[model samples]
Target: MNALGALAAFAAASSLFCGATAARHSYAEGDKVKLWANVVGPFSNPSVTYQYYERLPFCQPLDGLVHKPATLGELVDGNRLVLTPYDIAFQQNRERVTLCSKALTRREVQQFQAAIRDDFYFQMVLDDSLPMWGFVGKLEKVAPATPAEKETHRISLFTHMHFDIAYNLDRVIEVNVSTDSSRTVDISEDVTPNTEDGTIRAEFTYSVVWSPTDIPYAQRMEKYRRVQFLPQHLEIHWFSIINSCVTVLLLTGFLATILLRVLRNDFLRFSRDEDAMEDAEESGWKYCHGDVFRFPPNHNLFCALIGTGTQLFFLGIFIFLLSCVGAFAPYSRGSMYTALIVLYALTAGIAGYTAGSYYRQMGGTAWVRNTLLTCVVFCGPFFIAFCINNTIAIAYGSTAAFPFGTICIIAVIWALVTLPLTILGCIIGKNTRTDFKAPCRTTKYPREVPDLPWYRSALPQMLGAGFLPFSAIYIELYYIFASVWGHKIYTIYPILFIVFIILLIVTAFICVAMTYFQLAAEDHRWWWRSFFCGGSTGLFVYAYSIYFYFQRSDMSGLMQSCFFFGYVACVCLGFFIMLGTVGWRASLLFVRHIYKAIKCE
Candidate 1:
């Protein structure tokens, strides 16, 4: 009860914090609106980003104002916003204001040319609400006038920016940036990089135009929600979902028919005829009942995996539900990540309880080790990946790197809150644990498993079991990958929720069938086999990720490659554990049910 109360309070506080932050964007008239320069990267690869002024010879704000401290969400999203020198009052228009004028050195000129040639773009924010994007410069190829004439390319920098701010009454609703082509300076003519000292000076300027609109503040973000590719994505998403549902339906029907006919016949034959029971040649699942209830090896690790998987399952459902209900703003930077981190910390008790109870049920005496393993099962690999990714980011001078303070904060949360709660739950679980209570008693001697066909091997069964689940979500995985590694913004949470359910159902059903086959083959070693069978879906997912990286995405560079694979490996590991637990649980219930119905005496 105390734990429940504490969880409720923490949730309430988080809700309040999110609500307060949402309203911070609203501003009164004549308020000093702050402009923030965010990140710059190659337009072709969205994952590769760096500080806006990292290599640019741009002027900084002379006021020396301290940068706004980033939120947890912001840090997770790799958004670092620094105040720009641009000064503009809310709802007040400014015309042709000079930002900076400086003579470019030869190296600086070459840098600008390189940026233009590489199609670099920068991002900025207004009042920390509206985001604006623009290319660094334009590259054009001059067409040959005659057949013998050679075509030449020209590069020009956009020196002037025109910002159009739309307002509804007093609150800013929309922001747009337009570059004036007429105000561009020819880079080849004005900026000569061949000279020892560049003679050309670069003048950067901007203008603001405020326009009132009837669009409500609540609906200001509608523009971003209207993605052009959304219709196509929806079509694919729905089709894949329907396909998965049909597969599940067929699988369930097949299993049900087999149980009703084959299993019923076997049970009736065994129960009604004493001759059949005495037949030494009788070979089927009934023969394996003696050794089926035998305790599995490495029960501690199995318990931990089940516990952590249970925790992740619940966490996924909660996060998906919240997202579907718009509890977290989709456009809010790092909001999803922030929620995930906080909720994962708060849910540590669930993991501990699950692992501890299962450990006790398995007749294990090492409660402390079991509890510790549960706590670190998912987080352990994730932490290592986070460290590697952060190190790569820091080396590349990318904004994706988490600051030391943020890392310390995360560590503090884990130590002070997560650890204690997990320990408490472990204590409760240990006290409340009941016996395993398998319907059948294990035989003193283990049954010798007969050699089966190559197709009935563990490896083949795992591969077959995982393929269906992977097929269910492969289509949606593309959109997720695009959103994470590409430039797309993912907001289709309802569909995602549906697909998640479908994946779980498919995994559960497939694993149940696989276990039945294994048992029917007179193999009593279904414990770890079921787990590997279910978790093999993660292997498929990782394989698909490899395909996506090489064929589907434009992501490149060593840093991005490392970051992608590192984090994805962690995600796949979690997926493996989560689904593996599901499979094991489903198989356990099935095994218990079939054995309980037979004459176990």
Candidate 2:
């Protein structure tokens, strides 16, 4: 009895080994597979590529019905599935694992019929949404297999598994899928179910036909873009741009009027006539000529903020221009992010020099402290936020987390490339003094600020003033949020760049206007307020981000929430710094010019 059991076990092991060997042999390299599709679209040329199944799967588990459990390939450490492109194509027809509706119930059949009527369809996801190529070659059916052909089994063809468009007429749509080869054949009718014996059943027919084209890869890529934003949506963006432009134009007219007439009269009288000058000086902005150029409190920190802001401003412009020129194409996943990091690193010199020069000008003796702070102020927050997001992603077992090696590389770039470059920038800025000097010296004693109304208060004015800049980009913001979180494509970067310029112009105009009003009210504390006023636009942006998270996005889970909010905060902080600096610089120039033209002792 023991001998018999041993012999049986040995036979079972032998059979398992042979089955594994046969499976491996069926999917060898250089084998061709026919592509098939259940439903085709108006554009039927499918984009086919040999992609590793482990990296990008054709389909994944969606909510609802359980699929036929068939594991064709092995997964390595739950991070990646160990699969070759050949193995995936080999298992297409042979592996009878359906993704949705494994055993179609009567209700499911009705639902499918309804979905088909509504023009529901499937799309291929290679890197992004790839368009399907149709077949147009001659038909060549396989003959009945002999013993030899049966033993050496051939691989089946693969195609996109997209659904058909809804046709209300008969609740069915005709689709023609194009392929490279001409072996066209109709699928077996038996594969589809017919209503019989009080049971309603249905199945899809996946067929392949041969079609060929002589288009280059680059040309073809334009048609086969993934997750494409519809061209019709451009109208909405144009409308937003037009509306924002109208608002900006009106604001510009108001500023133009103020500068050309009202301020011009004040400057003329204050500079030319003794009586008119005294009257003007006694009442408005002309009175504070001596104190307008007063150094702001905590001058070192103020200068550092200005320096960092300048760096960010230039960095943003450089990146937007690059994107507009297609340096980072929408199809190239993560290219924008990579470009941003590299550019930021290269521009560290700008930040360093600006901070160093300003700190020196402000009479800051601690160069080391100022330099270190300049480097860390923005980067420190970003680094901390990134670490937090990475930690959460790691805990959630998300692929979004950067590996240790990547983290090390980033750190090295910051230390070796970004820091040293910033130092170099600082040296240049220190050597290069500004041509426009302050007309009056800063007083030893600070001016006493008077009580102000609620409307004129810094915080209230900032909050209200921020909305215009935010409005200029709110429409674009929606698309950007969609692209970042929804995994959609944002190719309309030219519009974005244009809007960016509009935002900057509007911010500058508003800041100058607000500073003029503040200074006219005898508030020499315009230094910090000017910075915060324009910077407040980022606050509105953060508010919009909150709105997007709660109302617009479909993202769920604590990890995702944390990641979204954390990163947005960092972005807003950077934006705030950049915008504030612009406002401050504009106010400085305005104050300096006015003071220089005035009758100052």
Candidate 3:
């Protein structure tokens, strides 16, 4: 062959040779193959790694089934098929095989198990619930196998689907499986019935060996083992539990201390004196003697803060509950959050109007500030999340998330749907008013809030308030953020959501107790103390995130997106919500204490 013609002839010959090699490698039904492997890279520091390995087929004996008993059945089937179901233990019927690796922590273990459960096995009749191209596989049973290294701790399970589907299904290699056990099998006999459509029902069952290869080794300890190599960053659920209990304990202590002192002074020292605290309260909380509701909080600010805060609390509660139930698990599209935020804002018009009117009734001014604060405090985080999502959009080179157009659409919806409704609510609330007649201790001027050591100041106490809530659930928050920004696939949003609720309750309780304690200490500066207690937990979350970032590895470019303005919005929202929580508690307590000390005429 000369030049061009020679090259063409050589290319045709090479193509034919490659095609033949591929056909030979194709796994045939009756053929026995040892393995499939990847000798190269899936890329450096891969999150989803590709691996190829040996495929070992295993099966269960067919002794219990009513069978045809053909010559084939009579000859070799009886030799090994003598496994009895009722009398004999199943441990022997099911065999074990080895796999490449194991998981280490609970998250890793969960991921490992789920990988197998969600994986399709042959003969599994995974129905129309999935698309035509859905993954389909079958594996009858699972069992632990011999470990390659005892210290390394590897274990494997035998999946019988391969044994049954191989065209040469007759010969049993230590064990045998039938088409019946394989889910992908298309046998006419529908012996196993799924209650729901095959596609709709989720099958989640798998077992795998879990071992931590790198341990307390110096370098490993500094790196991977620091977070302990979980499949997720940190699942917020577990950490929330520890934090909730601690918060409860601290709040209980504060309440008990205050209530005991109040009781002792009233019953013992004052000897049934109804006015035990009121006796010398003129210089204390009673100092706000004239017009305790001095600046009736902008008349519109009233219903706006209370109504909106209440709604936010309930919405937050539901979202967290859903999270705890795994609704927002890692595989779920993050778009759901955007959807939720949108829906919440649309529905919050009622709360907004209620608050606006209340503030108006309370003789408040600055209508613009009131309206703006309502939107900023309640709907602002979503704005930032939108931006972060946009950054992600840029990174992904797609506008699947809240694009600029979508954001404008959302803003319009909020304005048209929620804002008008809120204004209407304010108008309605303004048309009606209910008198709140509560007893209080009267005084001439505001009480000079106690001045003392720096430790007792509202600034320091606010810092303390933040600590407990953070302590109760910093770890849980870590896991949640990790799943989101760090791109860890998670499936336990519902459960973690419960932790969020518990965190809220615990934070609120702690704030109430701490606010009371500060009041008792003659620190009537409730505004700052209130914000400190509830808002401080976010600070802990921020601090912990930094610590975790240094420790985490193998990220999908999360570092760049994490420090952006979008994340700052998340931080700010967390702080403000906490601030609102503490402020609300302080306001309520301020009203209660003043009423209790008052001598109504």
Top model number, TM-score: 1
Residues 1-601, candidate 3, lDDT per residue (tens digit)? Answer: 3744643443343223222112112332333322211111112112222211111112222343222211211111111111111111111222233222222333333333343343422211111000011122322343335665333222222222222111112211121223223322211122332333321122222221212232322121122123433545344355557667666776778667875466445334333345664565443333343434343323344345566665566556545544443333221222244435444655476566656665655566666677666666556665667566656645643212233544566678788877776666655655564534435533556656556788777667767767766666665665666554443444555555656656666677767766556655666555434655566666666676666655653333442334333454575455556455545565566557644654433
Q: CA lDDT of each candidate?
A: 0.83, 0.60, 0.43
Question: TM-scores of all models?
Answer: 0.93, 0.69, 0.54
Ranking by TM-score: 1, 2, 3
Q: Per-residue lDDT for 1-601 in model 2, tens only?
A: 7844743443343223222111212223223432222222111111111112211222322432222111111010011112112112321232222332233444544433333232233322221212233321122245657856623212222222332221112111122333323221222212333445433332222332222344433343344233344666777878778977987998899988776587888777666767554554266776666677666788777777888898899889867766655454433334455556766887888888888777767667777777777888899998898888788767744445666766787789899999898778877877785632577866767666667788999888898779888888898899888876654567777788888888888888888888988987888888899999989999999999999988886555566677788888999999999999988888787777777777675
How many angstroms is residue 425 displaced in model 2 relative to the true structure, after the best TM-score fit?
1.9
lDDT of 2: 0.60
Superposition error at 461 for model 1 (Å): 1.1
Q: Give the range of the ten consecutive residues with the poorest summed lDDT in model 1.
A: 12-21
Q: What ordering of candidates by lDDT runs from best to worst?
A: 1, 2, 3
TM-score of 2: 0.69
